[model samples]
Target: MSVQAPRWRAMRVSDLPAASAVAARVHPGYPEDDAVMAERLRLCPEGCLALAGPGDLPFGYAVGHPWRSGSVPDLDTLVGALPVPAGAWCIHDVALLPEARGHGAAGEVVGLMLGEAARRGLPEAVLVAVGDAAGFWQRHGFRPVPIAAPAGYGAGATVMVRSLAP
Candidate 1:
């Protein structure tokens, strides 16, 4: 019999550690610290998502919030607060374990985020594609932007943006 896929759900206060585990596994260098992840959840729990498997740990996690598009948030640090009139939806972190890769799960999670952006009346979505993952974001309709990535994100880190469908 074929195995079932994990289900996507809103990230809650209880999922912090599991989410951190997944982030640490997928993003070893640019670790999104537990405190930073919690801050993102606080900024917009509705935008943060977790893929729950049969076990306690999450299969993947996508954390984000609406923020000003002119700048990117620091790597692995706390964003004290989102701007009062955030202009675009910023995808802060997305991580998936090996078993969760090459599946439709990531795309589905991004769809949920885009839907949230549209619902919030945000015109755009932005993210810093690390390493060679720019192609993945490009496939999702995000094009490279001139915005500079913050220090510690590595040399290949580049900002990308796309308009959300209203």
Candidate 2:
């Protein structure tokens, strides 16, 4: 028997609740604000994505917006809009439910997101990898940057970046 792969799509405004649930579950002890989630989708709908399986509810989500390279946004806080001169694609969060793990869905989403970044003429892709997820991002070619992470993202949180060049 084989497992069916989950599908990925642009995140809709209505998908926030499911995305929030997955975020709260996978990122234990990390904060997630409903309004912030909505604001992210509003700020850059192209960078917001959802992953789902045989069921209608989303099993995972990815949130991001175009941003500068040197600063990491605080967790659970809302940034009303992305900066006009946004140079890097800052991935805010990417979390999946346990049941959805091992399907390699994350890599698919990251690839799509990177393409979106390139399409928008962004040269760098940045993310704050919480916990040990840095290696996962590393597998996808992200390298750690020596920038400080925001408070409450917990220890081992790293700011990583990857080039979007082909």
Candidate 3:
């Protein structure tokens, strides 16, 4: 018998609790409120995804949305609305439990997010890489941008961007 590996899928509202748990586990140092995550999922469902384990519980999740370039939303704050003339895809957060790492699920979802951004006519994707995660984002074709990240993101936070243009 063979065991099926976990995979990324479109995030459903039902998965928010698991997603929040994943975030709490993976990013305890950079906490976000439950409402902040809910708002992101509500505002841009297409930008949210979950890596489901057996029984479909989320072991990891990604939350993103459209926003202006080179900007970092304040941590734990709810974004009232996405910008009307959104210029870039904002990768709000991606978290994975230790057990969920070491597979290609993260890369898969990053590609999905970037593809969706291109399809939406956005020119670039941006994110604040927290907790020394800049290298991971770099591997996925993101490059560090020389802009100061917000204080709430803590030290070593980097602003990264990847062009969605061909």
**The candidate that achieves the highest TM-score relative to the unseen native structure:** 3
What residue pairs clash in candidate 1, if any at all?
Answer: none
Query: How well is each residue in 1-166 modelled by candidate 2, as lDDT tens digits?
Result: 7755788888998899889889788876787778988998988999899997775679999887899866668888877678889888988888889888898888888988898899999889998888788889999999998888887687878989998877
- Where does candidate 3 stray beyond 4 Å? none
Q: Largest lDDT belongs to which candidate?
A: 3
Off by over 4 Å in 2: 1-4
RMSD of each: 1.5, 1.7, 1.0
lDDT of 2 at 48: 93
CA-lDDT, candidates in order: 0.85, 0.85, 0.89
Q: Model 2: which ten-residue window has the lowest total lDDT?
A: 1-10
Q: What is the TM-score of each candidate against the true structure?
A: 0.94, 0.93, 0.96
lDDT of 1 by residue, 50-138 (tens): 88887645888998798996567878887788887988999887888998888788898888888888888988999999978899899
The TM-score of candidate 3 is 0.96
The window of 10 residues in a row where model 3 has the poorest summed lDDT is 70-79
